[model samples]
Target: MIRARVGARDAMRILTEVARANGQIFEALGVSKSSVSRKAASDQFLSRSESERILGLAKLIGQVQSMTNDAEADAPAWLATWMAEPVPALGGERPINLIGTMEGQTVVSNMLGHVLRGGFA
Candidate 1:
């Protein structure tokens, strides 16, 4: 079963893919094991900012896949461009954290969804 909700689940799935492509997102995002565990618990609610962080990481991860598909694609260079682009902060209103945990099983479910659906777009 999916650990996160629809959007969050997809975000996490892409995040994992990015990790496979470039490096660990936890390390890149300065996310500690504890934070990951907390997020994976499915019982803890993540703040909107935290969720945005995950989304941002997921988008970057998606870009990695896109770059990999093109031989001439420069992932790092494109990553710089992505970072330079303006991104509006989403889920910033109120406390948008959910009271659910994202576990390994959930991640797997999300991954399966991506695999079945041709990856995140």
Candidate 2:
């Protein structure tokens, strides 16, 4: 598992980067940004299951990227691992609380670095 700090903006940026990198995968897989947006707005996206899936995909991509040097090499693995960890304290709260991400703009920078470079690693 990746061990580093990943904040809200970073997480969002990662998702966006993933979308951009594998937009075709999301499209072919039927995970549209619009759908994700709608779900997010309605507090429907990133359910525990969905969060798990997204994190799993993110980790896979990170792992693949880690194998190379496309960029985002310094991204925190804890961010992805956070998605897999359960939060009993958030009972009935947002399925995926990214408040932490919002607090860490550096993560955004990291994500931008990757997005700019294109793909994970």
Candidate 3:
């Protein structure tokens, strides 16, 4: 991803399949839809930073799958639903709300860590 620019189609695949998000997800990640559209039309790659954010989101989803051991191959779908659900650890904020920035992504990752550890109780 850092070496060669990530393909716009690849990013879109991550957004739709892994993140189960709409185009607004690009806005949340600070990527412009017009830009993505143009790049997709031209078969070009996304900027490094744009690619990084997409990869980061995919990594977060992958973490859910890993932690759940695939959970009968439903972890990705489950993560999409779980991301929108509020969590007490986040002051009742939904996990999806904190995923727009790197720091927020870390917090979400940590929150998942807590859950994996039996809620830190």
Candidate 4:
């Protein structure tokens, strides 16, 4: 399910909040901290690739929230744990290690969907 289009500013804000909540740095998302800060402070929109990254991350986070069905306060930690651990369906690769590229993000998203539907991963 797609959500409404998020503006660049909102994307950056969401990314920052998710990263902080997950105890991760911006670099984990293949973006520099300075760039995130600059984008957050400016009115300029993100480039196409960057926008995709933001949207992908948001999607994965949303999936994690849904799968865990945890309280909002614990969602981030649950997501962080899921991302950091190795997955059997991923050939034991940590989800975080694959999130740097679009293909990897798609794979992870699909894997999450499979798990959500009660399949083993």
**Which candidate has the top score in TM-score?**
3
Q: Pick the candidate with the highest lDDT.
A: 3
Clashing pairs in 2: 2-77, 7-101, 8-101, 8-102, 9-101, 65-121
Candidate 2 achieves a global lDDT of 0.42
Candidate with more favorable, higher lDDT: 1 or 2? 1
lDDT of 1 at 3: 32
Candidate RMSDs in Å, in order, are: 11.9, 14.1, 2.6, 3.4
Worst 10 residues of 2 by lDDT: 95-104
lDDT of 1: 0.43
Q: Cα deviation in Å at residue 73, candidate 1?
A: 12
lDDT of 4 by residue, 1-121 (tens): 1234445577667776667655553566677666656766776566666777778887787787777776654555556667787899899998888877899899988987887678998
What are the per-residue Cα lDDT tens digits for candidate 2 across 13-121?
5567544433333332234456566665654434343344445445545654564555745333433333334444334232133322322223333443454456442
Candidate order (TM-score): 3, 4, 2, 1
**Between candidates 2 and 3, which one is better according to TM-score?**
3
Relative to the true structure, how large is the alpha-carbon lDDT of every model?
0.43, 0.42, 0.73, 0.72
Q: Give the TM-score of candidate 2.
A: 0.37
TM for candidate 3 is: 0.80
Q: Can you rank all candidates by lDDT, best first?
A: 3, 4, 1, 2
Look at candidate 4 and tell me the lDDT of residue 80.
66
